[model samples]
Target: MKQIKIGVFGCNRGGDYFRSLLANNADIVAVCDKDDFWLNKAKKRLGDGVAYYASFDEFIEHPMDAVLLANYFNEHAPFAIRCLEKGIHVLSECTAAGTMAECVQLVRAAEKSKAKYMLCENYPFMKFNREIKRICDSGTLGKILYAEGEYNHPVASSDVAFMRKYKPYAEHWRNYLPRTYYITHSMAPIMYATGANPIRVTALPVFAPFDDSMAISGSHCGDRAAIITTLNDDDSVFKVSGCAGFGAHGNSYRVCGTEGQIENLRGMGTQVMLRYNKWSKPAEMESNNLYDPKWNHKDEALIEKEGHGGGDFLVIQEFLNCILEDKKPPFDVYFATRMSAVAILAHRSLLELGMPYDIPDFRKEEDRVKWESDFLTPFYGPNGEAPTLRCSSHADFTPPEGPMKAYLEAIKTRE
Candidate 1:
């Protein structure tokens, strides 16, 4: 098979999956990023003959079979649409689009273009998660009824300030985002574990205190958010939480079914527990906790090394295989768009005081038309995409300027 030439955007995050691409049926042709520091570093570390561009406009014009969209979080949709127009396949990072309207446009673009698109959501590829998928798919955990996923990464005031100030571009999406929008990490795994489509979405925001540093950093967006989603297949429900102000440091998940259930190690190191239900009152369920290498037989390196338990590498490899073999990726554009679209409606539900919103089935043509013109958002981009900083969690709160100044001073000292 011939090697597919690939160009990666956002060198900072781009570097994480480089080895994986290089190891697969692909060639690293170029990398693009405005951050000269990381850009120069990646160019040097990867050696000579590899083109590097500071401008995305010029980078897209480079000859390549595919492009990796690791740019700022909310900018992938527009960039991917342009790439598809250019007839280049796309492998995007997280949360497919910033708004529902963009989601519609993105789906339509991929539908028309010959090039394919895959959202590189890595959490679902984690060793435990993959095992959960296998067990559920095998019907060992028969008829999944409920699931839970959580991602809590609390940061100090200084790091949060620096992130708000000097990170990426001036109007970085993370700086002004609805808490529910960053739901991909916590929610994608459950969706992948079971092939369930979210039919309805409702959310409750975890409000931050007035004195919280995040509130000071122009993020009145809740410190965290809880989303309750009802699935289309069996009407199953999934509870997902993300960005909790202060809580556990990593990701965790749990799946419950009729025959058995499995849960992440969580605070218990690297072990996971598998339990089976019994009707006897004295012995209702059996539990086992240990690491079984057999669970990740498909890719042992992923469980032994690399980032996110080696999931970082596995997801990239899957994308490349799809491109090389002319196969559809595991997480295709439609499924990925649903992930982002559900988050958009979940935020809407929060704004309406936890009221439920029906998640439009984008698979149906009529459903896409209903939301074709619905792309408005509270948080904005350089293009006036949104106009508010606060979602429903906090009222009358504005992102403070004091932290911004402090963040600027800290970066200036470093320079």
Candidate 2:
């Protein structure tokens, strides 16, 4: 296949995956970031010949087949829409749209443009989760009754590097968002492995003191919330805690089917224990070496060495395969919306003091019009476009300024 020329936005996080693509399937023609530090880093790491841009407008003008958006979390939707409108393919990161309104618009944009839109949700590609998906689909677990997924990262206290780097941006609404807003990381795997559609979700925010403290510290917003979701033919419960103030680090999930249960083992990276009522208490178990080989069997050993537990490389590899084969990606726009839409609805439930909410189907074209004009994110103009940061909000909120404060200022100036 001819090499696909691409522009990668958000240099820091974009570096690894962009480099992986360069090493495997594509050419990194251009790179962009608001921060000079990342731009310089990308230059050093990806080589000097690649063009780099500091501004989004300038980056979009570069000739490229696709745009890999590794920009801000809340900003992905508008940027993806713009790229699609310009006839460029887009691969966006997690919680694809910050709000339900943007969710509808994003899907419509993809449908109209006929350009490939893929959600880079790496957790589903993790070896343990991939194995579970294989087994569950193989009919070994029987009908899935319930499952739980979590990305309960204590980001505030765990790592000093990110805390210091993002101190300024962390002070804003994008940083101190509602508790339920982060549900995708902790919830996507179950949805991916089980193929169950969540019909209704009742989300109750945990108003414990830990969350209140984080809010006061200008770190996180409300406390963590528990989502009681009823799937199409099954039921499940998912809870996630992502405060700088509390909880453990990393992502994990558990699946309980009518005949068995599977869980990611604690402490050991990527190990899991499968149990069943039909067999012994510890039905089966595996760790480390045995783990990676399960999923790596499909690709070369070199590709296996590339990503987060083999996931990062797989996501990139799949994106390239879909392009070459003229096929829709497994994690296409419809499923991507399914994985992220609950977070938006869950946030609504928190605002209503944990009222149950039904997630709307964006796949049905009829539902698109109801929310096209609604902009749910704290930022964004009524027309669903990015706005300029005003003088009062122009100051960069790196590490020390905190994310909550930076977030509010962002809404005031740019929203």
Q: lDDT of all predictions, in order shown? A: 0.76, 0.66
Tell me, by lDDT, which candidate is best: 1
Per-residue accuracy of model 1 over 1-415 as CA lDDT, tens digit each? 8888999998877888787787665788999988788797798878888999998899999999999988877778999999999999999998788778889899999999999899998888777888777767877677889998887766566564456334533345665667777788888888888877788888877766335443324344544555545555567888877445556588888888877788877876545677775541124335553554354356565435667776787888788889878999878889899888877888777776688888877778898999988867666675665554355466765545665555444544323
For all predicted structures, in order, the TM-scores are 0.90, 0.82
Error of 1 at 246 (Å): 3.0
Model 2 per-residue lDDT at 181: 60
Q: After superposition, how far is residue 90 of candidate 2 from its true place, in Å?
A: 1.0
**Considering only N, C-alpha and C atoms within 3 Å, which residue pairs clash in candidate 1?**
218-399, 380-386
- Evaluated against the true structure, the overall lDDT of model 1 is 0.76
Candidate 1's C-alpha runs over 4 A off are 160-170, 210-218, 279-299, 383-389, 400-405, 413-415
Residues 1-415, candidate 2, lDDT per residue (tens digit)?
A: 7888888998766887864787667888999997887888898888877898998899999999888888777678889999999888888877688667788878988999967998877778887888778767867677787787766655443333454455444333444455556565666678788887776666655543232213323343435444434444355554443222245666777887776777776566877777666452333533211343265454656556877776777787777777767789777787777656676666566556567776677878676776666565544343445423211111232223343444334333210
